[model samples]
Target: MEVVALVSGGKDSCMSMLEWGNDTMGTDELDSFMFQTVGHTVLQSYAQCMGLPLFRHTIRGKALNQDLHYAKTQEDEVESLYVLLKEVKKRFPNVQGVASGAILSDYQRFRVENVCERLGLVSLAYLWQRDQKELLQEMTEVPIDAVLIKVAALGLDPYKHLGKSITALRPLLFRLSDEYGCHPCGEGGEYETLTLDCPLFRYKIVLDETEVVIHSDDQFAQVGYFQIAKHHLEPKADYDASLVSGGEGIVYDVWKELPDELPQCTEAEVAVDAASTTHGELQAAEPLDISLSHGAQAKCRGGEHRRVAAGPTLCRHKG
Candidate 1:
């Protein structure tokens, strides 16, 4: 069934496309629909990286009111999406499904599903009802290199976390999830992410320059977004064909084997492990290989090495 993926250039939207493309009936050759909301302009680069045809329509009414409440208050925004989907239908002619990345937002899910119902398209929310923490870990396990472009939560430091990779923010996310009840996946407007590279991309995006905008700052909460000044898509010479050629990609598996209680280690142990590696040899080799365990080995790509531990633990180092 041909589908139209709703994307916002955020982690959930991008990851939802990756999840949908894993299904037997889905493929990389799918149409994408995006609402031209506040951050919608940056999605063009994201769509380019994925090599998908995008259909965009700017929301005619106020994009986001100062205060947003549930119910029909945002119905006008939904209508904008509905109009875009109709255009996608006109172009594709065979689009039967509308894919969404709603993890826990019933407000978003209900509205999108309502629109699809009127249009006779199935609403496919593959990421629905999944654990947010596990979902985030799964995202990092794959090649989804997302960076925080906006933050609006209590615990996150805009200065520290802005433009930091999602992989690097896992610990902070977990802490916020445990202490402050913040959604680990940022499903509740806690943060927003921009995917730089993923298995679905034909080219990788490199941000050339960015300006940080701080809308509000106080002790309780900090809100901000990164304005991309310039960026370009770099070609991926070793692009994995199997990712889009009907075979299972790196993100195909759902981490069901994740341990209930992951093993804990101290900072001293991590420092010791880091110090043990031969830095001189690593710098000299072109394609360095480092064995992490009996079955796991780290491979150097583009002078970088990412070591994956046994159970959803990642340790990255630059050579």
Candidate 2:
């Protein structure tokens, strides 16, 4: 099915797209309650890199209702998604689904699924409720080439850490997770990443200019973000072309810098007690037909007999 990708210029979202493994008809760049919009200035380049059409919209609604199950309202931000997706469906009639990068946030997952239901589209989230540390390691190994664009956690130096690549910062991130109780995958908003390149890209995104804007200067934890002033896509040769075939022709001699012993990643998901909201009692998401088998990837087959219900069931795993 031709699904529309929901990109937010972040690592998890990009990885989710990679996990999609389907033909993405296009991409929608949104600034909403669920999106990390700090690097939205360079988001347009993502379409160029992925060779897809770009659809963009600024959310015009506020978080008037903060609940687990969302009801349709004109004044809420989820409605803005509804509006944008409605336009997408109107323009691309064959588009059957919407893809998102929801990890642990039940609030975001339910809201997006709510909009998909209203629009009669499937909601695809390949990275829901995965262990944070394992997810982080997989992201780094995926070689997403993501960088820190925002840092708002303790023990992270805003001035010193901003704009550093995730591959280079993995050690520090894990250490901080052990000592400072930081979320290794940035699930708790300790930091945010902006993906620069991925295997799916036809070109590489390069940051030409940027400026760090500090939101807070507290001694312990500093809140900061970067404004991407200018960026351009570097043309990359297609590996299927005459110059290369069957593999990436570019070679790297990595034995010199490689460590002989593989490091064991024991980082687990940080547990946070979620209390009932005073706003209202929450409703649990409808149980999905998909399996949550450990160390196994559950795929949704395209058989006519296999139909994923269009509600708050968000997990669509890899092969």
Candidate 3:
């Protein structure tokens, strides 16, 4: 089936296109479509990088008022997309389905499906219902070069992380997910991403400069975004493909060997470990601490100091 991909210059959209391409290879011709929303025509660069013909439409209206409940409040946005697809259909009459990057947002998926239904186009949401964590890991494994462009959630430092690749932020993102219930793939509007490079891209986008725009700052959370000051697409042949293909094999190996049931550590075990050492006992043990600056002395059970050389050391002494 020939389809039009709905791109937003983001990781999810780009990754969806790559997956759709992989799935429909030899059977479908992929074209791209996008609505010029807040980010302007930056997505056009992405479409160009992918070497896909793009159909773009500018959305003209007051910003859709986000309601307390998720309904058809954003119908205007969908309508804009509807208009864009009609134009796409006029250009590519064989287009049968519309590709969407929706993962967990029913609001987004429903709106796109509604428009597709009206236009007699099938909505292809390949990323829908996939495990978020696994999806994130796969994204990195595919070596998708996506950077955080906007952030508005707790536990995220947009200043530090803005424009950093998703691969670099994987561990931090998972940590936030585990500790603070952050969406693993930013599905909860915690952040937004822009794809710089992917397998589908013929060229890779390089940022020459960017400006950090901060919207809010507080003790608990900071909200900010990156504005592209300068950017250009570089020929893929200019870089070493091996370095660009970072840890793809390692990620695949780890994912494939993952167990159905992951190991669980009980809270009781944690409490028992904590209870093993009282405050006073811990204070006493602190004095036996080995100075990490110099070669540390390991205190044995017999109270003998054994000199040990250290570049990096992990010392655990039981009293």
Candidate 4:
């Protein structure tokens, strides 16, 4: 079961795939209501660093319908995923599901699940509903090199914390969680992260210079964005990808509480790739007009971005 991973160049998205230990075959189309466009300009570097092809689709719709249960509508953001996945499926026919890093967003989960169901793809939400502290522990334990790019919390200072790795901010995060009721895992939009290097990365992204753009300078909550100005990819020594975090990829059937539309996936047949284009009505939909796209494909070569290491919490549905 090859899966098309949905990456936003963030920690959870990176970690979600890490949890499954699957190599992402592709990624990114900047700017959408559903995805983080910040640091999106460098998203292709992820695919490049991992030696995988990158697919893209410009989002042309807004979050028109915010219902807990998603139903497609014309000019809606959810439809963009539907179309993008359809195109991915068209390109990579072996893809069986999508990998997401969603931990607490039912809004996001429903929309993604909706798209997967329509296209016969499984929603591999490995981090769904997991304990936040544990998730953070696992991310840092596996040690994803990630930094805060955006901060919007009462205790967090974006200018001070921007470009700082999450590992370095753990104590502060825990302190803030106790003092200000902040989300330790940032599930509450307190901040957003960009993974500079992870097990999935073939090379590490190094920042030479940066410009911090302040969105809000409030006393309680200061919102700032890191406009990464100078960066380059530096090659790293190869190591065993599977042993990075002892994570195996998530499969659809491994989930207990799942919708009936999702197929019964087997470990023997579950893996993640990028791209899904099987929406019946979306088949003829016009392609989004965007130039931030790439289509080169690469097979995993040991150290290449490839294969999943399933985590410890796999649950199977009773047949």
Q: Any runs in candidate 1 off by more than 4 Å, and if so which?
A: 22-39, 62-75, 244-319
TM-score of 1: 0.68
Residue 204 Cα positional deviation in candidate 4, in Å, after optimal superposition: 0.6
Across residues 216-309, which tens digit of lDDT does each residue of candidate 3 receive? 6656667667767678878777544322222111101111222322221111110101112221000011101000000011122223222222
| Winner by lDDT between candidate 4 and candidate 2 | 2
| Whole-structure CA lDDT of model 3 | 0.52
Q: What are the candidates' C-alpha RMSDs?
A: 18.4, 14.1, 23.2, 12.1
Name the TM-score of candidate 4. 0.75
Report backbone clashes per prediction: 0, 0, 0, 30
Give the per-residue lDDT of model 4 (tens digit) for 65-112: 756678878767566667667766775787766777778777677777
The segments of candidate 4 whose C-alpha lies over 4 angstroms from its true place after superposition are: 28-33, 241-319
Assess the local accuracy of residue 6 in candidate 2 as a C-alpha lDDT between 0 and 100. 77
Mind giving the per-residue lDDT tens digits that candidate 1 earns over 1-319? Answer: 5666676666776677666552212221111111212233455554445544444333322213222222333423344455556655655567777666667765456666767777887776767767988889999997688898777787877788889999999989999999999889876567777788888776788889887777666567766667788888897887775443322222111113222221211111101111122220001111111100000111222332232211111112222
Residue 166 Cα positional deviation in candidate 4, in Å, after optimal superposition: 0.5
Count: clashes, candidate 1:
0
TM-score of each: 0.68, 0.77, 0.67, 0.75
CA lDDT, candidate 1, residue 264: 18
